[model samples]
Target: MSTADNNSQYDKFPEVAIAGRYHEAWQGWPQVVAALQEALAAQPRQKTVLVVECYHGVAQQELLKALILPLRPAALFDAADARRSTAEIEALIAGDLTDDPVFGRRSSLPLAAFFDPAKCAQMQQAIAAVSHGLVVVAGTGAALMADGDLLVYADLARWEIQQRFRRGELGNYGADNARADLLSRYKRAFFIDWRVLDRHKVPLLQRADFLLDTHQAGSPRLVSGAALHAGLRQVARQPFRVVPFFDPGVWGGQWMKHQFDLDPAAANYAWCFDCVPEENSLLMRFGDVRVEIPALDLVLLYPQPLLGDAAYARFGAEFPIRFDLLDTVGGQNLSLQVHPTLPYIRQQFGMAYTQDESYYLLAAEPDAGVCLGVKTGTRPDEMMAALAQAAQGEGRFDDARFINRFPARRHDHFLIPAGTVHCAGAGSVVLEISATPYLFTFKLWDWGRLGLDGRPRPLHLHHGGNVIDWQRDTDWVTRELVNRVEPVAAGPGWQEERTGLHPSQFIETRRHWFSVPVLHHTDGRVNVLNLIEGEEAVVESPSGSFAPFVVHFAETFIIPAAVGAYRIRPCGRSLGQRLGTLKAWVREEETPC
Candidate 1:
């Protein structure tokens, strides 16, 4: 079917694009290629262009022929070769030459200059003149073309390289000069770095108006970043800053040192008086949104107690809630605990609390498992009795009535609602998204472990009992053990419900696997795109003009709200068929007998 006809099927959900880099030899490339082909086939012919930037080798030439030749003869133009003599490019721009005498009858699309700022400006002028056509720019060509008029940027390098180039580090080849030109050129940008973007400094590159990230695609990063950026952009004309959080060394991996110069010890968890004294918190404040919990260190980074008075004056009026990236390193099973809802927090703690949260499993050891809720048929009285016995040291009640206990595998996601008794298993790392600013926890049990300080970790038994929903309810948690099991029919870029387990909070969660041109949301909520397991994809939105970004394994990205629409195009091989056995297991359990 035609692209428009296919896209009509997924009209309900917002559109998003995935873009990144890849090597053909990687096992994931097959899947990436398949997905890209599908997206292209389903996308409107006029609206889609498979833009690829080659660093070296004959791969670019082969890939171009492989992708474009079979579909239709594409209008090809080389930015590098086009600049062989500045005179030729000028002649084309001046409309004196109807056809490229050098390349013969094949249509020579407008060639943009890379590295030369003046030529880059001329190319921008030429593109603005063309109402519609397929144009491909590669290498430095992509960056120069990124002068800000394109709607999407698919960056292939790590965030640091992009940052360096934006910071005038790439030989100062007038990097700052190019940036000044880009400031007004694009509206939104997306990166492959899944960690939270730093709000403290100026953004390295603002080429993207809307960014679609492939890192940790399952979390709330995109939506959160969008909201913060939009708010900050509105209040201040300064550019949003991008900060790196993950250190490869921590994961036993090696990354170039210059990518991000992060000194965990140097991070100050104090308030700065220069901004707003009362509302000061170490958490980096962008605009209305403040990220208090450091994703890497798991510490409160902003709004110190000393600044509480000012914080109250600035934030107390709106009572903004907080968001955290709760990290657990060792395996001591988290104390079985519960968080009081908003009413309870306000009544008991004398402060408002927003407790909604979703968990995205980062990494886990083979033995890690979590204890969630109670088993079916376990009566409330039995649970209460177990609680009492455990409190009195009369029984091993913690393990007996637990309803569901399962190993924590990599990438597993779980939603914990208020009043649900839950505990993170040992040897697992997770990204926790929640409503902010309350530290209320009621612990039901701890493995009798001691803290690093040679003391038993403190327990909040009295309060824990208050929030425990004694009634075992498994209705809210739905588990999808596998990814992309049912082959969704190919169509225009769209989102489909990959699993029945959906989040019930103000935010709704959906897993979509698409190979089509898609548009993103304009609503205020952030869109977090995690590259759970894929080759490469691109997210094009209305912010900056089209630029390239990379998405590798285990990385995450945040797409901001200012981006009006988005599109996704696969870049590498395809991810293989679903994990068959895992799919069966989940289906059997979710299916009502």
Candidate 2:
């Protein structure tokens, strides 16, 4: 099928071409085995060694069960055997993986820190001893053994890793504690495991002979490493969408379930991580086979082309902006929350920036509203005491007493710079546009409800109090944060408005209402956009630099800085109809390098 055929907003699995065409890829075990066997056969009489270096959450045991007898290697060396003892790893990462519920210090440990030198040397010596047949040296750090006859990278997506963590099926690398708390596992992975793995993955992705998609347990996909790189480079030159993952939460609602055609069996769809590259994956279609790789690979391997000149120089390998859906329609209010200030986030969590964000209302019921900032005359001590008592179940937090609840309308944009307390109330579907420091939220109240895990959700009253900006009261918020829209430019059939993010935040948002094709330029920075009001629209390169991309309503697409210029207009069912798109980009002067 053509790439445009799957551009529907309800498409859960979106696939794109690699280098303008679907290259060859092997699907299932037999096809993968045939390809590897042919490669091994070309080596003639020499002892062939196969090295399978995996990401931390990959199932090594499953790979062994699938490849052990088929390859029939004379000897096998599992690289995990060389990992440091559990106690050693704990002591090593204790400082980085703190007890904080939603935060951790970023770790600087290298991949070499997780392995024992003597054990690795022993594994290398063992590889040398195998004189005949295939010698398989497998596991996450297997590449340290020796240059192999065939290097296969068994990669796992970060979202899949999180699911495995929630299911108690995985643990931090070199630490055999699979049954740790879900938040603890995520903390360690964020602070330590993923950091070291990415450092190791870059070199391997550059040199691996084959790339394997082991996302599913038994169904594995394989492709050449060069083809993988070519595909990533191709993606950097065009507009595309990452594979979005949805999850149920205590405050989830039915909006996404109906709008995105999500699984109806799920309790409620609270979040659709539509454009979070760090936790989402990309699918490259090669004929009938689809190979999945972490979206961050594109960021790491080709940050300049994918993220643009100024953005790459400023954020390095990070995708600075994120777009997600927060559904509170037909559900309870979201937890009253506050994000850390820049200095607080840097000193407390080792992050470079705070999660300064804005909410653009997608759909709102008759009574839809948002709780933002404190009242003009509210006292800090008075509000804190009420929140403390409410958090302890003494009474429900009195929103009317201290907070300003603004009536929300469709397309209304609310600026929420870091340190300003805010949350979307029930009866609204919010398109949350923000910086990428996603997990830094410090919740002060949770509406006296237990989490999906049947336990009370965590509260960070002390942290929230420390970071809350007392000056963002109702008077200031109404004057500055609420619906700060201004007409910027217009054409024969289109108009553009600057729908802010606050001046203190680095992200700048613009909304376009177009009935005819509207031109947009990347101007040396990446642009993230969504069709907020339309059935479908097509994004075309003015110079025919890449193929025309189609996006449906509520679907977010990224325009790489490399694209230079593109145009968008209503298409398919929405042709000639008025459409609206919300676009965000990093402000040139304000973005911290």
Candidate 3:
């Protein structure tokens, strides 16, 4: 479990050491504690016990201890002791927990259900008993209150929680196959947490008297009430930008390393989760205090505003689009894989939707290409047999003979609908835009490479075989999956080109090339955009001006549907060169599923 420390950016920021580790945390916890003290002072009760509620694995309980120990609360209710049995949680790993069709219904149930009923009653009794002395209630779901009580929400980024999971800080529920074993499980749990915790958020925010952002866990940001309201309103209406996070992988590339000025000490940067809200964070700065919350909070808080009526109708409260970078520039091909179809994923994995992805080639070397579908005449059974043989180390795979290969260059869009076999070959930087359903990829081959842990990577031959759409052979892939691009329209110094849709796709894509500022309307669907071929650009909207949000080369950004009309203009050196942007949105007709 000794993986590389992913967040080397901490070296450039002020850091504090806690729990035998150093982290890039703002030195703001004291301010938040002071605010809590002030808020408690106004309670006019001698027994002022603050209830700290947070997402699971957020180290806020430690923070609460540090903040409250000096006051010597008469009773400290540590709610962790009330957690449900691990066996019970593991038993329900594959059961749907929420009624929401698309999200909040996968893997383990929500943490709210993780508490033992008896322990919960005990905790409630403890809250009731505290009247003349100080009492402190702290943990996930600890702020479920009685009459006249103080509540505080300790927010943490889902990405940070996932990182902690990777470090084995969270308990293992038998997902020890690889480093990414719990990735999907964590995502599923997070969606449920959003449902379980978010309904109480508005009330908690308005009445809590204190709000804490503990993204770093060691240090928390305290926002004043006025500033919190302003920040929340801004987030509700403006274009949303999650704090981008990077991780190194077995097939990672160096393109992002050189482009984003990231820490180069690492071997390479693999995935830049630029705007996948479920696994990314949004830093909300209020005055000198800041708080980091899951980007999913926006969609949960303002479903119609952020995703619009059309998107909300289609995907419920979920943000349906995801944009991330898959860099193979100095590495190897991504695993030969096929995502499950919607039905297949639901039946086999308990997920509502499958990963329907598209690789928009942002840059590639001359020999770089994509391996897509199967060769012209390869049978589905034959491919499955070969995959089984390879998985068992029986023989070498003639990938060229078995998989169709096509040369890819800048701006090439390859549609990867579910069940299509594909992999982005080396020497390319691919901006993957697709449905938000990630972590269902059924890897068939890994070019005989071992993972970072020195173990052979896991392959889902049995599962993959069940889902491969064998008919998507070479001819169909070349003629259809490889996008059929055509100019759609043009305006002053700008033009729109439609990246043709594959018949199986639910998302529509297009690229905009402009030398001067150009206005684009969201038109009621969230837009996932990337500056595929530009140095930088400005994104301004009627809702608010995010001047110099300054998207650099290959950086992904999002425009929430709440920002109805927005303009993008070339910045820096791109003023002289035509700035190219690739964007994807849910198709209008496909929005009512």
Ordered by TM-score, highest first, the candidates read: 2, 3, 1
Residue 274 in model 1: shift from native, Å? Answer: 25
Per-residue lDDT tens digits for candidate 3, residues 1-593, read 12224321111121111121212123465655666666667887777767776666566446756676755678887777677666765555445544322233543434456677888888788788777776877776676533336776677666776677778666332223235555444655454544455555555666654556766656666554445555555675665467788888899999777766677689998888786877777666533444666776666666787777987887887888889888889988899998899898787656756789889888798999999898888977777787788888998777877899999998889989999999999999888988887867778999898988687877878778888888889888888888788899998899999985576777888899999898889887888888877677878764564433556666667777777789889877678788999888888754354
Span of 10 residues, lowest total lDDT, candidate 1: 579-588
Worst 10 residues of 3 by lDDT: 9-18
What TM-score would each prediction reach against the true structure? 0.42, 0.96, 0.87
Model 1 has an lDDT value of 0.38
Full candidate order by lDDT, most accurate first: 2, 3, 1
Candidate 2 collision pairs = none
Error (Å) of candidate 3 at residue 15 is 19
Better of 1 and 2 by TM-score: 2
lDDT of 2 at 143: 89
Where does model 1 exceed 4 Å of error?
Answer: 1-330, 350-353, 362-368, 379-397, 407-411, 427-429, 474-495, 498-504, 515-517, 535-538, 542-552, 568-593
**After superposing candidate 2, which stretches have Cα over 4 Å from the reference?**
1-9, 19-23, 590-593
Candidate 3 is scored at a TM of 0.87
RMSD of each: 23.2, 2.6, 6.1
Evaluate model 2: give its lDDT.
0.89
